[model samples]
Target: MKLAELAKELEISTESFIKFIQDFDLELSECIATNFDVKKDFEKFAKENKSFLKKYDADLGQNKSVEDIAKNIQQPKDKVAEILEKDKIKVYDNGFYKSSISSYGIHQKLGGNYQFVYDYFGKKTNLSERDFIGYRDLFFFISKTLDPFLHLAPLTDWGIHKPAGIILYGPPGSGKIFWANKIAEIVDYQFKQIKKYYFGTSFVDGRRANFNDFLVEMMKEDKVLLFMEEFDVIMSERSEEKSVSSCDEETKEIVLHYVSQFEKEDLLMIGSANSLVDIDDEILAPGRFDVTIPIFPPNAHERAEMILHYLKENLSKDAILMKILETNNAHHLPFWKEISSKMKVFSNTMIIDFTQSLKKKIRDIYLKNSSLKITINEKLLESAFREAAAKLTGEYLNQVAQFLQDVSINNYDDFPKRIEALKVELDSYKMVEKPIKTIGFTHNGDQES
Candidate 1:
């Protein structure tokens, strides 16, 4: 959005606005930046003067009547008159006193000065085509929350509050952080991240001030999305742990403050974590994260698509690639599409790394080499994928199984008994170590069949 486009929407003369910005002490370059914040200066200016809004708007447009001003400002007509009287701003006539007399006023006498300065910036999202690998239903459900009637008070009659926040909880590398920012972009809200460890002594004492500033600014917008990554660092379930650290106490205080404001603020707060099972239930109760979404490592079909996302640029329609992916044939895809799918429970990050290494391997061996034998070393790619995939799947699966166990076992008296009972079921999902895990590769880059 350029200054000229902004001026058209603001209905202000570009020249006058350029000069008026000097009042806020902003350089011309700063305002021209992509999606800059002008409210900070506007609020400062408004506080400095009692009758600034009316005077500010009037300067840009015709002096608006009481009814016109009330409608434009979204205030009652009577309140407009009260402000006029309180500020001593007047319209002169044969006798002056017009609030009780007429429905409309003379524009010239009113002094044309109306300007629509109150802009609650909220960008509507148009993100149907952007794929986050999978989670198709999750994105669709989130997008539906942006309906015009989503904020309507009438819907609350059903016992569901208008969605104020959504929590995305899943194992690490499930791409919770990616989806959070994607949601922000789709909904056209300014995305801001909250750090994981602010409660430590190394952190500033005025941490609450920083939070207040962000929350206050967020409330100013019609829709704003705040992303808190790795939230469990401070918001871990208090009941689960007996001892409360100073950091946890500070986090509790900060969360409580926002909980109070959540009801009134028009915000779409998104919090992401490896798992929210540990996060305090109170912070997410009901309207807080009215929608608690669970994201898992991509399924087999999703994993294949994810691999194609990175490889499609180089190898979608290649049959050898599909063979290495352990598929008979790809119905629709590029050459790099068929890397190895034998690797299970690999995070999207791991797939990305795996695919990148394959591309690099191809570049180094086949694409860069001048030899007549331009065959891909299937065994090398398989080895890389196996090593990467086998890194954390076993450990993470154990954590997930343990978390499920924790959710079920409520009584401390029978905690160990319940865990032991779950141990078998948990082990079934765990990856058992095998002796022949590595692929046999020859100098020619082919597997020894």
Candidate 2:
């Protein structure tokens, strides 16, 4: 069943259902496929909450003012307004709340119990079976940033136009491109990468090609998201100390020329950068690529979930690797948590490397002693961990530190927890000074023979 069909059967508007999802931070991709196939969990949730849906729709249908909401919910008008303000809800000139507000939302403001909803939909904060492992805070933050694109009320009533350009800043292997594609999916836009060759005058099939022409064609499409990597280099600040390459300068100029029209043309441009320090001030202007999201390496808890996810994704239940994991209880997240805690400041790429190395080591061990049962002991796990940790060098730590500084300046309040967690991890790599001892000369001054 499609979400629209489910909404119709339940006698509710699709927008109401979508609002409920947004309020709860549920990704439509998890509950509904591209072909509009609704997941069984979501369908069952809708069917079981028929009365709730009807009441939710009815409450949203009422165009209530602050006083009306206060009266209905038996809260003070000042309190109601404060809650709305805290949530970033905007009202009209007549003082009525936006259509996006609902009784469910008000109840949530009053601290009503909604664990049942999360329990039914599967908690987004925990380890989910979805493609991504964990980063509930980042996902929620990104969702809010994309809200203007999801609903017109933010744009129409609040003057919050969709972001023309966004920069995903983080260290390498932190999945900047992954979030770019995720934004494309959420907005129902076509995902297209702007390649290096596209920046230069290149030939395709003996035909002349240029970025300006390609961009014009892209704007002609219904809705499109253009992703460009190495954004820091391409949009580097102009300076006499370090000159920008001609190719990069040209590309930056072309983008600046067309950027103001992105929202009008139903287009969005996302830039992926390892660090934001080098991005030009013009590029970071209010109406330009002002919004910056910081992607961090997974923390210990998330690293464990990622390891378990990779293991399940690659190994079959009956495979030898699975057997060994089960024998040592390594198939579960708790077992991986012990080892993941040791991998301080490990990137998502390092987690993957650890899994691959572990698999190879296990395979080699099994081949050497076919008749013997292989135990997943510390020695085996440490060998793989050491190999993966090789990538966690001083250079990588410095990159992480730089990323932390950039995020602090750009988006500190939006993600303090992530920033703090990453800072702690990076601090773990700091070199502590030890007291040095002077050469011994005591009563045995004869060279301490």
Candidate 3:
């Protein structure tokens, strides 16, 4: 019910309702003034409660008072006071409040600052380090390149000194963003991530004045790292036609300007692109991006390490199976997450059993989908399932069958019925079956049917 309606039903004005809440020692002044409906208030209350429960590891039923909550949740009294003021959930000196007000406020403030900075500077912090591979060589390179930056000493002319810009070029799934973040963190500089679209816009506008303003602000700060991901769209060469105006030209010019400025001001700039050759010659020339780091696809050794990392953190046991399934050139993180989610349903100790079970599941899926009577081992089954799942399409019943074949079932016969039901569900989308080739029996001398 709406607060106003509830207030009217109780035969009191909103202000009076708020006062009544205060009497109960649960502050409602702000909530009443804001006129936020009861639904929103309840949601906020529930979220705060959950956060409090998680943080304190306390049982909600045991505590009902704010003082009890503050003590249990291990938050400062002032922090609790602020939450009471904002939520208008009457906090009697004894009422329960779950989330720390100061922490929540600080988090929100930081998020807002990030958003404002991103809007103005066209940069964000992409600090997900889950994709770095071949740690030995990469680490060696990082240690070497970042040594001077870390020590706050001028590098020799051979070293990367006052680098205007550096390019991280490689195939997708290469750890460009991860490396960029590590560099920023090591240097104790603010890392800003800029999206591809922002660069495209900057290119067309001839000048990203607003973005430049943000960059200038960062310049005033002690140290900053501006990371532009998918840099090809902006830094790529413009068309030869003088009359033609493309966003690419404007982007290159703006980037060039920034690179030159950074060189003069001793700022660090990094750009990442999948296609290195697409980069504009003007920007790639001597002063702009002098150091070009090619982030090659992970070789066998790196792949092995990445597989082990995923298994250690995400897998229960089945490391062998995880390694087998970690093929296909797509990004590794999503695949790892999917496998991790799948493994969660089974017992951690039973990973070997689960691996065998998954193999059977994949075989069943393949048989149900494909016309070929192929004999698939556990490893093969796992690979097939991974591939099908990776590239599964709505139109392909076989792909759906391949994915669902391994799922747990209480009734085996009902599985087919469940599949039929899925077909019916998919009928609304006008999905068509992909044609499959008929497999003919191969014979040397003996005839086979």
Candidate 4:
């Protein structure tokens, strides 16, 4: 059964059920397949926790104002407003808070007794684990995409087969390659990179090589996830108006010929592309490279966690840098939130760049003043921040904007909050002021509201 179907049976909204899962910190993989199929465990849990689910649905479904939240938590309205303001939670013009703003998180922040929620649900688990930072939504979405491989229901019941090809599309430095490998792990396939030399006609070792022959050998192997980079350029739209390279043209033809045999042969091909705008329609049709997952830059919260992960995880516990971070509460998420807020739309590479720059500066300062305790302050952070943000040039901004456009068309419903967050970040770079636009997918086409 689908998650929506389960929610309907339980007499609650699908949105509320999803929120409940998130608030209670349930493992998405344990609850539902990427295709929204209700896992047996989650279905059982929901039915058994009937009373708790109703209360959760009632509380979270309501559009809450400061007074409403204050009353529920037995706090003064003024105090609630102050706490929300300090935490940078937005209050909508209508006086109610945005639905995305978690009242449960706020309740805990303001010292409300949220023990009942936790006691019933057991201890909550964080969505972002050590191996993966954020992108819980993306993880769930991709899980569904891998359903044909992960479960037999999709194939046996729905006649859906494993995709032969998938394209991971996003701006530069968004970690498309990382996701390609992750897909391989989830499907339990051997991850192999298809080097550029194997594309068309090239020499392998000491002999002539052809991509078709290479693909044939790969098909002979047991369960392989073949990753190809520069996919957009290699499989660009074939048009008479523009000149197409012989190699690229031939590569496209060979892939089209072999893609059908991939699923039966237990071969999965993943393409990494920076943009999807130029890719040919045939490459995106069903039974081809139709599955496209957008790899977004880390959000504000993710940025903070990522920075802290890079800094503390890399340094020794008793290291001077660790001590410096400790002094300023840099070990905590709150301390990094302020700095991360300034780094909207920064890719993972840029976050690493910030950490690298910050580390070097800390090292330099400690060297010059060996006897003195080096303080990590705004002055030092600002310098490193500026250096890291240098890559946020106009060209990068344009690429992000294009990514937003493409994702809205393809996966809007799957990631509304991310879309809005990225749009706000992208708009920050605009020279002229414009209201943040709500872009949604419609049956007709993309409509702005």
Model 1, 1-449: lDDT tens digits are 43444445555534334434432323322233222223344434433442553344444445446666656555666766865564344455642332322211222124333233223123211122123444443443444454322334446555545557777766677788887786776656777776543344342455444455556666787766778776665677655545567666676666666765664665767777666567777777776664665555565556676766665544444544434343423324443345533444456777787767765665565445643344455686676675565445445665445444443443222223223433443333433235655432122112233
Query: What local lDDT score does residue 381 receive in model 4, on the 0 to 100 scale?
Result: 92
Instruction: Tell me the tens digit of each residue's lDDT in model 2 across 211-282.
Output: 988899899999999999999999999888999998899889999999999999999999999898888999
- Backbone clashes per model, in order? 22, 0, 17, 2
Cα error, residue 322 of model 1, in Å, equals: 15
Per-candidate Cα lDDT values, in order, are 0.51, 0.80, 0.46, 0.79
Which is the better candidate, 2 or 3, if ranked by TM-score? 2
Off by over 4 Å in 4: 1-19, 25-114, 117-129, 433-449
Model 2 lDDT-worst window of ten:
440-449
Best by TM-score: 4
Q: Where is model 1 poorest over a 10-residue stretch in terms of lDDT?
A: 120-129
* Candidate 4 local lDDT, 264-337, one digit each (tens): 99999999988899998989889999889999999998899889888876566688887887877777788888
* Candidate with the larger TM-score of 1 and 3: 1
Output the lDDT of residue 17, model 1: 45
Model 1 off-target regions past 4 Å? 1-130, 144-159, 196-209, 239-244, 313-340, 371-373, 402-449
How well does each candidate superpose onto the true structure, as a TM-score? 0.53, 0.74, 0.41, 0.76
Scored against the true structure, residue 15 in model 3 reaches a CA lDDT of 37
Task: Point out the higher-scoring one by lDDT: 3 or 4.
Answer: 4
- After aligning candidate 1 to the native by TM-score, how far in Å is the CA of 413 from where it should be? 30
